[model samples]
Target: MHKEVTIYDIAEKLSISASTVSRALNANSLVSKKTQQKIIAMATSMGYRSNTFAANLRMQRSNTIGLIVPRLNSYFMSEVISGIESVTNDAGYNLIISQSMENVDKEISNLKTMFNNRVDGLLVSVAAGSNGLTGFDIFRDRKIPVLFFDRAPHGLTVPSVTIDNENAAFLITQHLIEMGAKNIFHITGHQSVSVYKERTSGFKRALLAAGLPFNENQLIVTDLSEKAGIAAAKLIAELKGDGVFAANDSCAATCMNELKLQGFKIPQDVKFAGFNNDLISRNIDPALTTINYPGFEMGKVIAAKLLDHLSHKSDLHSSPLITMKSELVIRASSNYKP
Candidate 1:
């Protein structure tokens, strides 16, 4: 095995004190540029590497931010993470990402690991089953900044960023109603989540505004998976609703496929709309009409806000909630007429 080079080795070669070498390596103001360059050159020649643990101890900062998400496989979540990475990297910060896999226990474990790592800040999109976060108290107690985006905890005082789910769902529902869709069926995920709850509420509100009867049988709550989509389509076919509003595109695509197999003429027999303009939405046989939720933009905004708070030590009380606008995209799936 190759021997590990140390600062003492560099100091011995340069005939300088280890303290001077340490100061020079850390780019401290006390070290002159000439000495710093000489020390760096000698260290490079000796194959020396800076000890991040020691440096972190000295600076009292990790220079790393922690991020926790439900899952990384979803297009929307992946795009959001990419956006966050872009901003954090530009700001000279490293991000440590972990997935909770929609499990409350996994989320708790991830939180503990992040806290132990002493991350400068944390960004989280809470998992599905996470009722409340008792473990996050470590961050609160330590005064580390924590920001939530997307699926955030309910009734928390932490800063959060999300889209206007109610308005977006209402707009999409209205669009379906205007296309001559009567008896609209709403397919959504777990009602425990604020996003799904708000979406369901918006759907009901749209029905009320249109003076249409809202049927409890028309609402289907599932796991928001492709399989759930197929199951939802079967239920929709049995119910024979004229319109279907799926909470997400993945489920919408699966439902559409199943409905097509059942010989239902899309848009003509059952006008359909989905949320989140995912790539799958456009690739489906009849392109899905959806709301552009801007996941990437949401991620970028959340990360930028957290970084700003860290740098400026700004009070988070000013903006408790940051809601982004969503735009509706009209595509073949919801276009009943030519």
Candidate 2:
């Protein structure tokens, strides 16, 4: 293995004191700009790597933040993480991310790992099956700032940022109602999640407002996977609803394909609408109509807010909720009338 370069080596090569080299590397204005540049150039040429642990201890701060998400494979979650990285990297912070795969046990393990690493802050989107915030007590006790985005824990004091799921779902449902969809069906994920529960509530509210009956058989709850979408399509075929609102675009696309195979016409016999406005929404034949939840923007906003709080130590007690807007995109899937 090659020998690691250090500040002492840089100082020796530059014929300067190690203290001067350290100050220059730390960007201390006490050192002249010319000297700092010369030292940095030499350090870069020598392949000198800063010891993050040592630096963190000396500064009493870790420049790394921890991020925990239910899963890492989805397009929406990936976009959100990308946006977070952009903002955190610009602010001179590193992100250590982990996925729970929607398991509560794995989510607990990830939280313990993040706490052990002593991250400056944490960002989390709790697992769907996570029943409570018991695992997050370590952060709360240690006074480490934690921010929740997207799938947040309900009734928590931690700062959270999310779009109004109820309003968005209500709007989509109203759109279907306006299209003469008397028997509308809603395909949703686990109702334990605030997002899914709120969406279901919004669907019910819309039905009541329109004087339409909310049929128990019309509501299908599943895991929001492609297979679930296929199953939902088959189930919907059996039930035969005029309009369908899926919790997400991937499921909607799958259902759309399956429904077509089962001899159902798109937006002719049955209209469809989905959420998240994901790429699949545009790629699917007879493009999916969905709600634009702005996952990427939500990430950027949450990251910026967390960084600001870390830097300023701002009082979070005043306002705990940061809500973003969601817009309904009327595409071919839901646009039945000419």
Candidate 3:
């Protein structure tokens, strides 16, 4: 039977104390660079495997960050996960990711599991129907850092990283107006979500600022899915709105396709735009006008900021907010020239 190799075996082989091997393995500053290399080489050759669970217990930290998002099915979230994992892996941290599917009950349950696992930090993009977070007090009591991103809850003291949704929506709507669109409609997700709520506000603000007609009926709320997009397109066809701004590219792309099937000439009979600069935005028939949301960058910032708070000292933002920059990309879908 083969015996499990331990750090003690490596230390005895190198004629050094186990403490020195431990320090070298953890990359302690006290260990010389040349000695660390030797130790690592010997450890690797000897088939030494680290017991991370035991090491974490000794350090009183799990080196794990819990991430909760509304859903992971979107391209935006995929980019975010890629960026976050890159930083976390480099920093020797692991991630425990969960999706809430926009369900408040599931979100609360996810929070409980994270807390039980004793994660060192947490990142969240809140679910719909969760306007506020109350189950986070346990994490707060334990001194675990929690950062919100993209879809932060309302009235929470937790620091958040996101783009200016209100302003972005305003810019998109204003661009439609500039394109000679007299009647504009903003198709979005659950009105309760902060991003959607802010976008609706921006849409109204742009309409009011442009001296155009503003009413609640112009704000079409949906699940922001492909089916929702088709339904919204039908509604827009009946309403005869000259401009349509969906909250995401998927909805906007599908809706635009449906509109084209309905015999409407894009940018002529009905100008359209979307958000998130997703791949679909550029591949469609006429291409979609959209806002270039930096999902990957946002993820990096969220992870880095939390890591900064965890390592050496606390470096949290005093304002509890980090607003990322987003830009509008005009395309054939909305760039109408009279």
Candidate 4:
């Protein structure tokens, strides 16, 4: 087996101090350019490699930010990740990303790994089944900055960056009401998730405000996946509401397509609305009205907030929540009667 090569070996072979070799390898200005070049060439010839992890540990920093999300297989998450990577790479920081797959145990395991690695900070969009910020107290105990985005829990001191789900849902419902929807059924995700819970609240609020009866069966709780959307369609058809609002586009589009197959005319029979202006919203026969939740922009802001705090440019302790702007988009799916 080949012997491992390190800086000391290079220094000994070149007849120089290890400090000089170290500075040269690290590009310290203290080492002369000519000497640094010689050291580099000798190090390369000796097959020596830099130990960045050990070096970063000695400096009490990782230059790495940990990101924990619920899942990676979605357009919204894809855009968010792209935005985060763009900023973090430009700032010379690395991201250690992990997904919980909507499992609380997996999320906890990820958090433990990030803590052990001594990440500079952590950004998390909690899992769907997460009860609350129980396992996350370790970061706070260590004074490690932690930020939550999108799917955060209620009553959190850990600052969050997310759109106002309640307000967006309320607006969507209100629009349907103004369009003469007497009964608006809402398709949503697990009620344990704050975003979905808030959306439900908004839907109910709008219905009550409009003096429309809020039916218990009108609110369907599902994972909001493609299959869940298809399954919910049958129940939606039985409920036979004049308006249907989904927490996301995937479910809304699938339900719309399924309802269409059942001979239901959109807008003319049932006005459809959804959150997250995903591509499917546009591809549907009559474009679906939705809330334009800016995942990419939210990602940029979340990374910037934690990075700024780490760099001592700002503090986030006082600011509990940062709300991103979500615009209500109107389309052919939601047309009002004169």
Which candidate should be chosen as best, given lDDT against the real structure?
3
Model 2, residue 181: C-alpha shift (Å): 0.9
Per-residue lDDT for 36 in model 1? 86
Residue 181 in candidate 3 has what lDDT? 93
| Tens-digit lDDT string for candidate 3 (154-221) | 87766999899999999999999999998998899888899999988888899999999887778888
Evaluate all candidate structures by whole-model CA lDDT and list the values in order: 0.87, 0.87, 0.89, 0.87
Clash pairs of candidate 1?
Answer: none
- List candidate 3 segments past 4 Å from native: 1-54, 317-319
lDDT of 2 by residue, 119-146 (tens): 8889999888785487989988888888
Query: Model 4 shows how many backbone clashes?
Result: 0
Q: Mind giving the per-residue lDDT tens digits that candidate 4 earns over 92-208?
A: 999999999989999999999999877899999989878557688898888899888998877755688988999999999999999988878999988878899999999999998
Count of clashes, each model: 0, 0, 0, 0
lDDT of 1 by residue, 1-338 (tens): 99888888889999999999888888787999999888878887787854432356577688889999888888898889889988999988889999998788899999999988778899998887675566788988888888888877877766888888998999999999999998899999888787898999999999999999987898899988999999998889988888999999999999998999999999899999999999999999899999998989998988888888888756554787888888999999989753
Model 2 TM-score (2 dp)? 0.84
Best by TM-score: 4
